[model samples]
Target: MGKSPDIIKDTSETLKPVSGRGITVMQGWYDKNIKACHVTLWDLGETDDNFSDDDAEGVTLSVQVTIFSQEDEVELAREIKSLMKADGFSFEGRNGDDSEPEDGIYMKAQRFSKFYESEE
Candidate 1:
């Protein structure tokens, strides 16, 4: 029921408490120049929706997260995934490719989707 931007904002905020220590949380893409631990969120698409005058239900959406770090960030990723799961989001799946764009930047990513219900 929540809009894509709203969901993204919530996700970013949820991750904010864990941010710092050379890591940053952001909605959408982060600046490309600074090569540190960065977390970016994106709304991929809508899956389905069931709505009435009183409420909106079964509304699902896909979200993408890209992590850039100098070393392995599995723990950080897991923390994020756990946070999302605990926040009532469903884990759709994830990708296994990690990249080093330039020299010390290690990049990893995950994708998830969840259904939301809200009063309308």
Candidate 2:
């Protein structure tokens, strides 16, 4: 099985504290009606066990986290970076400059990566 579900669950749990007041932490996509912290995952590659080349060992994945808010998002973005890092993700950096996609909503995206060892 893929580690997608585990990653998503960990992300949701890590960001749950910031999930009220019309804002939410979601996987894959977000609702435009409210503020959101959206997470998208991509499997980058896999590694083989060092001892035996035939056995799969782990996978590396890239996680894109985008935050959309009706207010300034710098503080929230920093908080998210800290939280995700504490949860074992290595911060890769911001994906792009912050932008206002609509009249009042602001958006910022960041990248992170993690390696998950295969389950026996």
The backbone clash count of each candidate, in order, is: 0, 0
How would you encode candidate 1's per-residue C-alpha lDDT over 40-91 as one tens digit per residue?
Answer: 8888877556866655566677788878777878888898889888887777
Best by lDDT: 1
Model 2 segments beyond 4 Å from truth? Answer: 1-5, 20-22, 35-54, 99-102
lDDT of 2 at 75: 81
Per-model TM-score on C-alpha atoms: 0.76, 0.71
Candidate 1 residue pairs in clash (backbone atoms < 3 Å): none
Over 4 Å off, model 1: 1-5, 20-22, 50-56, 99-103, 118-120
lDDT of each: 0.73, 0.65
